[model samples]
Target: MKIYDAPFIRAADRYTIEQGISSADLMERAARACSDQILKEHPDIQQVLVICGTGNNGGDGLCIARHFLELSMPVKVLIHGHRESGTEDFSHHLRRFESAGGICESYSGRLPDIPQDTIVIDALFGTGINRPVEGTAATLIEQLNESGKTILSVDMPSGLPANGIPEGTVIHAHHTYSFQWPKPAFFLPENAGYTGSWSILDIGLRADFPGHEHAWGEWVDSSFVLPFLKPRKTFSHKGNYGHVMLLAGSKDMPGAANLCSFACIRAGAGRVTLADDGREETRDEIMHLHRNKLVPALESGQYNVFAAGPGLGRTPSAHTLLKQCLESFRHPVLLDADALNLLADDPSLTMLLPAGSVLTPHPGEFRRLAGDTSGSLEMLTLQQQLSARWQVTIVLKRAYTCITTPDGKIYINGSGNPGMATAGSGDVLTGIIAAWMAQGLSPTDAAIAGTYLHGLAGDLAMKEQGGLNIIAGDIIDHYNSAIKILRA
Candidate 1:
C-alpha cells in the first residue's frame, strides 16, 4: 500500500469529495468505519468519552458517539471548542447527535470523574494540523494521557504531525483508526508511542486517484511482494538457481558465517560457498574456503552474487579481504556487519563499492556509515541521500526495516516482530538478500523482497517460540514457510 503525507492525503480527500460525495457524507463514512472497528474489537465498551475539537475530525467523533448512543450504550461528547464555531461538517454532526439526545459538554480545565472503563476518543486534530498543539488543548491531551484511560484517536493523534516528528505535546493514544491511508509518521519509531496500534479505515476514496501515483513511500506487505516471486521451472537444474559466495565469519565469530550460509541455502540459493578460517563445523551442502583462497575464488567468476561482512572483524586482514571483494566482484555485493564497519573506518572504500550494491546496516552501523542525525526522520533523510549518491540500496534494519533504493523510493517493511532483534538476525538478512540477488532479482527487488521475507520468517518463528524465545536460527528455519505463504 502506498503511503502519503498530509497534503497528498488532503488532496485525495478533496478529489473524493469532488467526485460527487459530499464532505459530510465522507465524514460519516469515516466515522462509521472507525465505530464499527471499535465496537467489533471492544464489544464490552461500557462507556465512550469523545474529546472533540472544532474541525471535521471532531465531526467524526460526534458521529461515532451518536452510533454508540443509538445502540443505547453510555456515551458523552466533550467539546474543546464551542459548537457554533465548529466547521460545517462538525456543526452538522453535533446538531444531529444532539437531536438524538446525546449528552454534550464543554471541556473545562479539569477532566470529568467518569468511569474508568470509558474509552477516550481523541478527535482534537487530524492530518491537516501543521502547528504545535498548545494552550487548553495541550492540557487536555496531557490529562487524557495521565487519566489511565484507553485512548483511541480518530485519523491521527491530536498533536502528532502526519508527516514529520511531533513538535509539542501529543495525545498518547492506545489505538488510532486513520482514514484512507496510513500517515508517514505512523511508520516511524519516534511516533510508535503516540500511535500505539494503528489501522487504516478506508472511507471510499477513489481507487484511481491520481495523487496516489506520487506516493511518498509504500507499506510493504504480501500483496506488494507477491509479484516479485517467480515460479520454478520443472526442468531447471541447480545451476539455474544461481550460486552465492559468502565472505563471512571470523575465527572467533564463526557462528555468523554458519548462520548466514544456512539462511542463504534455505532462502533458495542453489550453491553457497562460505569463506572462513575453516575452524567451524561445515554443512554437507556448503562449500568451505580458507581466507587465503578468497581472492582467487572471486576471479573465477563462478558465483552469481557475493555477500561480505557478517562476522568479518575490523582487522587489517579483514580490511584487505573486503577491499579484494570490492575490487574483484563485478556483480552487486551485499555488505553488512563488520564489512559496513570497515567502510566506516575507511570512507574511501565506499567509493570502491560496485553500483547496485546492497548495504544492510543496523542503526549504529548506519550512523557510522552516514554520520549521526537528530532522529529516525533525519536518519531516513540521510539514508535516502546516501543511497542516491552512492547508487546503492541501503537497508536500514530496525523494528520497521526501511529499504531505500537509488531511485529515491522507500519501502517500510510491515512484517517484523520484536523477537527478531536477536544477534545473527542481520546476518540472516544479508544471506537472504544475497540469495535473492543470485537468483536473478535486481538489486532493488532483492532487497525489498528479502526484507519482507526475513521479517515474515521472524513472525512465523515468533508464532512457535513466542517473542521472548525467538533466536536468529529460528528465522532461518522458517524461510521455507515464509516463502510458501508468499507463493500461496
Candidate 2:
C-alpha cells in the first residue's frame, strides 16, 4: 500500500510500458478491474452513463462501456472533449463499441439527456489533472454530483489534486477505483466530501518496480504499519519490554488514569508504573505491582517511557505532575489531553520537554497550546513550528491524523473510521503509544504505529457493529486483533 506522488504513478506506468505491458493493455486491465468490482456489487445496474474524454482516461471509460455492452447491459457512452486524435487504446475501443452496435453519443457542449436512474461513470479527468477543470467538463461533474445517482470515478475523483489539498471541481464519487496504487489526495480530510469510499484495484502493475512514498502520506493499513511491530520472543524478559512510567488522571478523573493504565497493560508493557495525582479514588484503581501509582514507584533504576494526560483533571495539582515529568522524565514521553492544556497555559513548560517526546492532540487541544490559527496555512505552520521548537514528534489529531517528525516529514494516518471519535479514546491511544515506546520503538515509529493500530482497531470494530456502538473499550478489545492482523 505504498502511496506515491503523481509523478511516481506516471513513472510506474513508464516502467510497466518498458516491461512490454503496452499502454492499451494497461488501460484494459484497469477498466476490467473496475467492471469486475461494479458487477460484483451491482449486477442489477443498467443504463450506465459513461462520460469519456479523448485521452487514456477516456480509454478507461470506453473500455468499461465496451465490457458492459458485451455483458448485454445497455450502456450509453457520452464522449466529450475534442482532440485531433485519441490514444491508440481509445481509438481501438471506440471502433470496437461501434462494431458491437453499442449506443454511443458524442457531446462537447451540452450533456446528453440520459435517464436519471443511470449510474454515472466519470472518466473525464483522472489523476492526470494538473489544473482546475473548466468549461463543459466542470459543469458536467457538478451536474453528476447533484444527480443523486451512484457515481463511480476512475483513478481519482476528478479535479482533486494528486497529493495535497484539493483545488477545484471534483466528481463526488460513491466509489472511486484507482489503478494499481493509491494517490495522496485520497487520504486528505477536505477531500472527504468529494472522494467517498475508495478502493485500489490491482491492474497487474509489477511490484517489481520501486515502491511508493509518503508523498501521499501514510496509509494505516496492516501492510504499511505492521512491519514496525515485530513479533515478541517467548524467551523475552520484563526488562526486554521496557518499563513505562505513566502520569495520568486527576481527582474524579481517576478513570482517565485507569483507562491509560489498563490500555498500557493490554498493549504489552513489561512493567507499568503510574505517577498519577495521588488521590484517594485514584489509589483505589492502582494495582500495586501490576499498576504502580506513586512518584516513588516510578523511581525505576532504568529510564522510563512516560505517558501523561488522559483522565488527568484540570487542576493545580495536575499542573505540578506534568512539569515534574517534563523536567525529569529521562525517556521518550507521550503527552496528551490535560497535560497539553497545561502546556498551553504555561509557555515556559515547552522548554522543559525532553527531546523526542511525542505530543498527541486533537485540533482544539493543539490550538490552545499553539494559539488560535489565522487560517489553514497557519494551522500547518504552527504544527511545523511546535515540532521544531520542542524537537519532538507531534501527532496533530484530526480527520486524517498526522504524525509530524522533528525533521518535518508529515505522515498522515489512513486508519480508523469516524467510529473512533468517542470519549476516553485518546487515553487508549496514549497507552498504545507508551507500550510501543517501552517495547523499544523510536518515538516516530511508535506514533505512526500507534495511530494506525488505533484506527485499524476502530475500523475492525466498526465492521462487526456499525460505527454507533464504538467506545473506548471496543478499541482496547480490538487492539490485539489489529496487531495480530498486522502480524499476519
Candidate 3:
C-alpha cells in the first residue's frame, strides 16, 4: 500500500464531502465510532472529558461529546481558543451540542481542574496540522499529556507532523482513534510513543475518490490481503508450482536452512532444494552448490526462485557464494541474514543485484546496509533512496515491518507481534517471499504478500502456542493455518 501524506489525507476527506456526504455527517460518524470503541474497552467510563479545538477536529470532539450525552453519559467539552471557529461542520456540531445542554467550557489560556480518573479526550489537532504547535494550545496539550491521564487522541496526536517522527510536545495518548484511512504518522516507528494502540474507525470516506491512480499506503489486515494469496489448484503438480532454491545454514547452524526449506515446502513450492556448507551434513536433506554454498534449484531447464543468507556465516566461501548470486541469478532473489552483512562490507556487491531483488533486513542489518543513521526515520529515508536507486525492494523488519519498492512505494506491515522477534525468523520470511516469487508474483507484490503473510502466521502461532517459547519452525507450522484463515 502507498503511504499517504497530509495533502493526501485532506484530499480524501474533501473528496468524501464532495461526494454528497456532509463533513458534519463524517465528523459525527467518526466521533461516535470512537465512542463505541472506548465504551467497549472501558465499560466503566461514564464521565468522559473531551478537549476540542476550533477546527474540524474540535467538531469531531463536540460530536463525540454529543454522542455520549445522547447515551445519557456525562461529558465535559473543553474548547481551545483559535483564530478560526470553523463555519462548516464545526458550526453545525457546536450548535447541536449546545442545544443538547452538553457542558462546554472554553480554554481561555487555562487548563481546567478536573477529576483524577477522567479519560482525557484529545481532539485538538488532526493530520492536516502543518506547523509546530504553539501558544496556549501547545501548553495545554503538554500539561494534559504529563497529567497521568488515560488520554485518547481523536486522529493524529496533537503536535505531531503527519509524515516524519514527532519532535515537539505530543499528546501521549493511551489509545488513538483514527478515522477512515490511516495516516502515515500512525505507522512510523517513532510515533509509537505518541499514538498508543491506534484503531481505525469507519467514517464513510468515498472509496472511489478521483485520481485513484495515485498510490496510498495501507495498514495490512488479513481481510485486505487475502485475495493476493493464490489458492492451490487440484491439477497442479510439484513441478507446476516451481522449484525453489535455498542457500542458507552454516557449520553449527543447520536450523536456518531447516526453517527456510520447511517454509518453502509448506508455502506450496513445487520443490525445495537446500544448499549450505559443502557437505550436506544430512543428504536426504537436499541439493548441491556449484562452489559448495551457491546452490540454484533448477528443473526442466528453468530456475524458479532463489533465497540466500539465512544462517549463512561470514566465511570466505560464503562471501564467494553471495558474489556469485549477485552476478548470475536471473530470477528474483530474497537476500537476508549474513547475505546483507556481506553486502554491507562490499559496496561493489550491490551493483551485482538484479532489478527487483528483495532484501529483508532487521534494523541493525539495515543500518549496516545504509550505514549508521540519526534515527529510524533517517534510516527509512535512506531505505527509500536505495530502493529507487537500485530498483529493488527493501523490507526493513521492525515493530511495524516496512516495505519500500523501486517505484517509491512504502508499506507498513500491521501484522505480527513481539513473538516474531526471535532467532531464525528472518529465514522463515526469506522462504515465504521466495515461495511466492516462485509461484509467479512480481518481486514487489511478493514481498508485500510474503511479509504480511509471514507476520500473520506468527500471530496465528502466538494465539495457539504463545510467543515467548515460539520457535522458527512453529511459524512454518502455523503458516498454512494463517493463509487458510485469510482465504476463508
On TM-score, the leading prediction is 1
Worst 10 residues of 1 by lDDT: 275-284
lDDT of 3 at 179: 76
Estimate the TM-score for candidate 2: 0.88
| Model 1 alpha-carbon miss at residue 392, Å | 0.6
- In candidate 2, how many Å is residue 11 off? 2.1
Off by over 4 Å in 3: 1-3, 82-88, 108-110, 278-302, 467-469
Q: Model 1: residues >4 Å from true position, as ranges? A: none
Cα lDDT of candidate 2 equals: 0.78
| Best-performing candidate as measured by lDDT | 1
Order of models, best lDDT first: 1, 3, 2
For model 1, residues 327-428, the per-residue Cα lDDT tens digits are: 988878899999999999999998898899999999999999888899999999999999999999999999888999999999999899887888999999
Scored against the true structure, residue 232 in model 2 reaches a CA lDDT of 73
**Rank list by TM-score:** 1, 3, 2
lDDT accuracy of residue 323 in candidate 3: 84
> Once all C-alphas are superposed, what RMSD does model 1 give against the true structure?
1.1
Clashing pairs in 1: none
| TM-scores, each model vs. reference | 0.98, 0.88, 0.92
